[model samples]
Structures are given as C-alpha cells and as structure tokens.
Target: MNDVSFLPHARLDDLIQLLLTQGFRVIGPRVRAGVIAYDTIDAATQLPWGWRDAQAPGRYRLEQTAGSRCFAWANGAQAIKPFLFAPREPLWQARRAAGCFEVQELVPPPRPLAFLGVRACDLAALAIHDRHFLGGLHPDPYYAARGEEMLLIAVNCTHPADTCFCAATGDGPQAAAGFDLALTELDDGFVAQAGSQEGRELMQALVLAPATPEQRAAASQAIGLAAAAQTRRLPAPERLRRLYQRLDHSRWEDVGARCLSCGNCTQVCPTCFCHREQDVPALEGEATVHERQWDSCFSAGHAWLHGYQVRPEIRQRYRQWLTHKLAGWQAQFGRSGCVGCGRCISWCPVGIDLTEEVEVLLAEAADGA
Candidate 1:
C-alpha cells in the first residue's frame, strides 16, 4: 500500500469485473448520443477512450484523438450529483383507507455503487453536498440511503477545458482526498493509488505491479500541465464574498439583459440544491405521492411570498443567485458553493461566464473606491 501500482490498459477490464464480483454496479464515462456522459458500464470498452472535448463559454464539442487513453477528456455535462442527489424522487405517499389517511415515508432501496473517473472539482462539490444533505440536525434519509454504500474512484484531471478554474478554487487538477482509489492515466496504462482500506483490498485483488519511478514522474508532470493549461479563473474568495455589497452595480443589469432565465445553469451546476415538492394524486384519488424535484432561483415561483413575487426582475434574480453562491454560502457552509467546474458557463445558451462577470464587477468596485 505504500507504493503506487500500475494497472495496464489491457487489464483495465479486470478492475470492472472485480467490482462486479464484489456486488458493486460500476458507473463510468462513455459516449452516448454524441456526448460524454456518466452511465452504467460493465466493461472497460464502454469508456470514452481516444476522445477529447473542446469547451468554451456556451460551447462544448467532443472529438476523437489518436491517443488511446480512456480518461483524456476534461468533463461532461453532468457530474456525479445525479447519482446521489436525484433530480426527482418520491418523498412520501398517503393512502385514503378506512375513514383515515395512512402516510408512509419513502426512501430508495440501498444499492452499492462504484463511481469511476471522478474529477477533483466534482469531489469538492460532492463534499459540499455532504454538508448540505447529511450534515444537518434533521439529516436527509433519502440522501443517506444512497450515499452510505458508495465507492468513489477518482481520476486526477489531465485535460482541463477552456472554462475550467478549479485551480483558482483550490480544488483541483489533482484529487487530494475523498476517494477510495485514485488513478493517473498514462499512455500505456494508469498509475493507481489506494486512499481507503476498501481500495487497498481491491488493489490486492487486481494484483497490479508497482509503478516505475518514470511512470510516477510522468503522472505528476501531466497533472501539472493540466493546471497550467487552465486559462479561466475566479477572483479570490474574499473578493467574491463582497458581491452582495454591490447590489446596485450596473453590471448586473448588463448581464441580466442578455440572461435567458432558463435555469440551465442551476440544472448543470453540481452544488446548487434548490428543490420544490408537490403531491401527485393517483387517478382514482385514493392515494397521493409527494415528490421533490429540482428548482432554480431564476424561476418566478422561487421567490414568491404570500401572493407577491420577491424578485420580479431578471436582474434581481441573477443578483440573488450570484450573491448566495459566492457570499451567503460561505456564511452557511464555511465555503463558497461554486467549485469552479465551469459547467454553468459551458451549458449556458447565451454563453454567460461567471468568472468574467465577477472580474468586471470587482474591477468597477475598485475604480469607484
């Protein structure tokens, strides 16, 4: 366990088979409908090998590369969020029976899942989610059931997209913790290290050979290159925390004018946790299923109070989201909500970049001072 091991490309499938033998359903990145997405995979061939993604503000395209590395791509549209924090789920059910109503709390059945190729930025976001969902006095049973038996296999990032800024967030290019196992992909294979007892046990089963000194050096060099290649970055956390002080900044209006208010940013964001709950009645009116679905601050109903809308304008809604994500989140959770994965920028229809907006707003503030 002291020395890192090398998992050859040829024996990569053995890792998947080992996980399956241990009662884990393996999920990994694969090409589906022209995009790299995380899905259930039973073998190594399902991974998006020899592929690279080109990403920018409001743009993403996947292209094939000659290299045979499986984890050469930066990221996809979705993170591991959906696996834990489901987009939609039933909360409870009420049945009308014998002159009384019976209520039953609903929780998903436990299923051991092994997530493969998790990036450092996403690992950071996942920690934030752990705080939100499981770190409260009234812990969420639904989130707990799914999270309890999960295994994370992190892959250090080697290909950062144009919009990536995890380096600025102090989250990535390398995964420091929160993984059972960590892998660094090289041309011939992956340099693997175990971070947990479960990972160490699995490593023994794989029977991998100790990684050579050159392979370890190459892995380090590749991660360094990825960190250097990132061109986008956020302002310092303290600087971003001051966003609330500039409520009347004209930049808000400028960005709001171009904003779509479509909620794509919240949907793609790994840490945004707004949701709304409602009851869906059965056709016969005999039973009702209460369900919770993801929501966004941009929605008109999100800020509604009694009968009046708290934030009627696009500028106000946008300001609320930015302030909470950068400032209020620190007060609530001791850190900013954004992990700087850049999904919000790439998935936005109009290509709104939060980092660019933060720089403009802070620059104007400094000029005024």
Candidate 2:
C-alpha cells in the first residue's frame, strides 16, 4: 500500500489530538529552561514554534525566528535516553512487616508514549540502546517493558548544526527505519510517510492528501543539503586500532588537564548506560529501598573495586571513556558506541572536541609507528 501523505502545517493539532485520543502520552519538542527539550504536550501550542537555537562547542542559545517552521533548529541537550533508561529509578523496596522483611519489586507502570520531532541521530542512539538492553545476552526487563510501548515520530533534519556529524557516521540527515512515521518538513507543510502499520492508521485520521512530486523533491533536496552542510567528521575508524597501543600517549594528559571530570558527556550521551545500584535504609534501619542511578566513568568512585581504585587518575578515566566509545565498544557490541550527535562537544564545559582528540591521537600514533 502507498505510505506517503501530506499534512499542512496548520493541521498539526489534529495529529496531536489523534495521539491523545488513542491513549498515547504524547511528548514533543518544547521550549523550556531557554532550550528545546522533549516534554509532555497536550496541544500544538506547547511545541517549540518559531524557535531556533544557535549551537557551538560549549555554547547554546535559543532565539525567535520569523519562519513558521516547527523544527528548524538542531537537537537540544536531552535525547530519548531519559525516557527509556531513567536517570534514577527505584528498583525494589524491603520493609519490616509480619515480624520479618517483605520485599517487593517496583516495575514502572507501562505507559504508551509517542515521541515527536525525534531526529535521525537520536533514533540511531535508540537503536543502539535496543541492541544492548534488549538484544544482549540477558535482556533488561525494565528497559524492555518501557521500550516496547514507545512510538517514534522522526523528523528529517533540514538545517544541520555546525557541530553535527551524523552524516560522517552514516546515521542521519534522514531516518531510514525504526520509526512509526517520518516527516520531512517543507515550507508549507510536512511530507509524511508511514514506516509501520500503526503509522499508516494514524495518517488516516489526519485526512492527509497525496504528496505531490514537488513536495517529495523538496523533502529530498532539504535532506541532501543538510548532509552536504556538515563540517565535523570523526577520524578514520581503522586508525583507532592503535588506540590501545597509545595507552601511554601524552594526549591523554593534555585532555585530562583541561577536563573537569564533571561527567556531563556521559549524562548527555544517549547510549552510555553505566549505572550503579544502591540500597537506602530508612531512619529506623528496618527498611531499605533499592535504587539504580546513572553512573559515569569520569567519576572517581567509578573505578572503586573492593578496597582499591583501579583508575585513580583523571587521565585514565578519560582514556577509558574515549577508547570505549570510539574503539573498545566495537569489540564488545559489534558497533561503535557513538552516533555522532555532538552532544559531547556542545555540553563540554571546556569545549573539548573528541573528534579533534581522536584525530590528533591517531596521527601521533601513525607518526610514532
């Protein structure tokens, strides 16, 4: 069956209403805390309308635009990670009851969610999470339960951010799959196409018209321009084979000197899933609550094992993060951990670019060899 449809810009409200009526807790891009972020939305007014952001290394500022575009800006700091793998969650609780301890696991209630304005790189990150949490040797029950109820509505990027390098990673400028519906925003409306059965059913409620050749061509041209516009590119992946060989490389010290070890990069990274579990006892010390919170290798406590800290130096911690993200992850996951969304670049307090570091490190390694 034909999967393409055209929805005029004014009719976006209908789409939101349809999702709400279908019992999906809809979340979309909204302006909050001076930036665009995914949040619960009940109407079209809650979206980041006519808002654009200027982004650079360690910089972000939102500004009003004259256009009617709903998603002209590049991504914000937040991604879909928080929605699936929560930052902090209660796993189970143990209480003193019936002259003994009673333990009950607290699984989050499954709520169907529809994510709007999801970008291609973000979508790729979600797929990578699926591989780890769902396709791993033993699937995580919590992630699996929450992930299955999600509906993804991807938006094709027309304006690429200066820091964006999804094209170099072959992850974006356009979403290829794993979405219920994909939209390419044009001047007047969106060229929408279904990627799943549910998406087709949702489009029927919008009463969308058949897309014209002009609209389809405009969509293709917009993404093409975005792809060609990217300037940031990672160092050759093949060169990273010498990454472990350069363990004692002096570059680690250079990056470590400026690195604050703030753990912001891992927090913003959509695919970094390191977490630590804790048990908190009540004031009476009779009851305890088991919780899991996101953890990062940048933290000093991350290397704590038994009575010894394996990686006590900040340089060692930073090296572990970069090497794992760019190289070691390939050995474990059969794919690189980075999706090239550039959040690590933009969110760094010191504005350190991993792309630059990798390039320099690889070049030095080649020269030394």
Candidate 3:
C-alpha cells in the first residue's frame, strides 16, 4: 500500500469543521474538577492541551506538559460505555388498561458519534464489544447501528498511564487497527494518517496534501517514542491462556479481601459489556417500563438464580471474571474479553491491578510440582 499522508496541519481544522457538518457531536478530553474527562468539546482548545496528567495508585493529577501536547492523559474516569450504552434506556413499555396489555418498543436516539482523541486501547475495547453485540447470534440493534456509524479519530498515546497494560495485550501504544484516522502529536502539527474510506474522504474534503518525507519520518518517530513510554507492561501473552486454564489458589483469597465487592473494576472496564434487565412501572400501574442496565460478574446479583446465588464467595466471583476475560471468552468468541485498557486496575478504589494478579496466578501455577 502507498504510504498515504494527507495535508498535515490543515487536516485538524478540517476535521473539526467536517464533523460539525456531518451532524456529529464532537467530544474529547477536557479539564474539569482537577482531572481530565471525555466531554462535549467545541474546538481543539477544549482538549487537555499542553498538559500531562500525573497518575499513580489512588492519585491522578494533571500537570502542565510540554508545548501543545494533545492526548497527554490516558483513560480517565469514564470509558466509552456510558455513551454507547446509555445508563438507562427503556427497553420497552407495556400498558395495561381494563385488564388489557399493550406493548410499545423503545428506540434510542441516534447521534452519529465522532470520537476524537480515542486511544488505541479504547479502539480495541470497541472491537471486543463488537464481537459480542454485533457478531453474536442475536445482535443488539441499538449498539450495532452506532458501532457501524461512529467515526474514530484515534490519538496514538504520546504518553501512557502507570496502570495501562495495552502493550502486553498487543493492543497498543500505537494504533495498528480499528481506526478511521490516527494521529501522533508533534511540536508544530499533528501527523495524520487515514485508515479507511471515511477518513480518506475527510482528508480530501479537508484538502490535505501529500505529506513531506520529513513529516512521515516524524510520525514514525513519534509512534516509536510512545511505544517506549508505556510505564507498565506485561512480559507474556501466550502464557495468559494457560494461566487461566489452571488458576492458582494462593493469590485468589488475598485479591478477594482487597476487592471491596464494589465492582468498580468491571464498571470501569472497557470491554465488560454485561447488562441486566429490569421492569419499571408507571404511576397507578397504567404503564410499565422495561430497561437494561450495565451489570458485572463481580456483583452479588450476577450469580443469583433459582432463589439462590451461585458464586456466593467473593473469591469465586473475582476468579470467574478474570478467567472469562483470559480463557473463557477465547473459547466462546475466539477473542479476549479484555482490551488491556487498564481501567479496571486504575479506577478500582482498592488499586487491585489485573496485570499483577495475572502474573501472580501464572507464577504460582508454574511453581506447582
């Protein structure tokens, strides 16, 4: 394939303008409440520009970074789930009048998303979700349409977080797949590369010219530097499969104790797409509401069935989740449920790191005579 480079600097402004015209509500990271979050951003200025965030266990603070640094922060408080799957949406409503029932289906609002500043890990998470919701036997019409239509303008991580482990999972510090456009922040301009037809059209619309040899070189160097800056990484990938197949007993109890049963890890995890359904009633029982909300295997309710809850032990629940992401998901979907975004590790109130936990399991498993 010919190395296609579009007009570098002009593409940024053009992308903004094009997205606006395309009826997409553009969103990216912005500074709020002393941290970075994904929010409705009008212009590039809304981005956490020139600011690098400091993240450690139980701490996240954004400090002023070098000149014009966009996407300097890794995944913050929220992943892409809330936007794709709304916190609450009426699944359908049933109305009863005079002992008669009528059913009404609910269709969610369609707002074509232009996810600016998406990281490679989030892109990978989207793919993971795509496997279940889109590629499954019963596809979710709600999620499928949005997934198919959303445009991703990925930001190659110029900086990664302390908890991030995408490198180990072969997801990225640099985007290799599942992006319409990929960007690497540079001193003067962003190195923009288009990966698909939509991106190519946008580039053409933006009137981006062929990149200079030096610009192409700069992009390559930027990707390399980002790949190296990953502060946390795992040594093995193939071994994870075996580790999951046979879990170690030693580390399991300690993790269960540290885990608050808060289920924050699963809530924050990018690829954890489980949800529970509920029926809600309107005033006077004239009408009823049915809804689907996000659920986690970590939760006590997840195992509830036949008037009893299985996996009642916190240890069992945690083990099941980790096992599924590594081994069970592969058996079912032929892919790992985890995107290696590190959201579970970073946002867990107790700082329960999945990478550390995985390593422990594998180490103990190997030692058993």
Quick one: best lDDT, which candidate?
1
The model with the greater lDDT, 1 or 3, is 1
Q: Total backbone clashes of model 2?
A: 0
Model 3 TM-score, 2 decimals:
0.92
* Model 1: colliding residue pairs: none
Tens digit per residue, CA lDDT, model 3, 1-369: 233564444246567877988888887788888877788876766777678766666557778866566666777877676778665677788998678998987866667888888888888887777776777578887776555568888888867777776777788878888888887777666777888988888777776657778877887787677667666655354566775655556688988888878888778777887789999888796999999988889888899998999989888889989888787777777767776677777677777777778777777556442
Better of 1 and 3 by TM-score: 1
Compared with the true structure, model 1 gives a TM-score of: 0.98
* Colliding pairs, model 2: none
Tens digit of per-residue lDDT, candidate 1, span 1-369: 654899999999999999999899899999988789999999999898899999998899999989889998889999999999999999999999999999999999999999999999999999999988999799899999998899999999998999999998999989999999999999999999899998888788888899999999999999999999888888777777778778889999999999999999999998999999999999999999999999999999999999999999998998899989998999998889989899999999999999988888888666444
Worst 10-residue lDDT window, candidate 3: 1-10
Displacement of residue 175 (Cα, Å) in model 3 is 1.3
Order the candidates by TM-score, highest first.
Answer: 1, 2, 3
| Model 3 regions more than 4 Å off | 1-3, 6-11, 235-237, 244-248, 367-369
lDDT of 2 by residue, 1-369 (tens): 468989888898899999999899999999999988899999988888788878788887889988889999889988988999999988999999989999998888899999999999999999888888888489887887787688999999998787899898888989999899999999888999999999998888777888999999999999999999999987666666578888988999999999999999999898899999999899998899999999999998899999999999888999999998888988877768888888888889999888888887887667656
For each candidate in turn, the TM-score is 0.98, 0.97, 0.92
Q: In model 2, which regions exceed 4 Å deviation?
A: 365-369
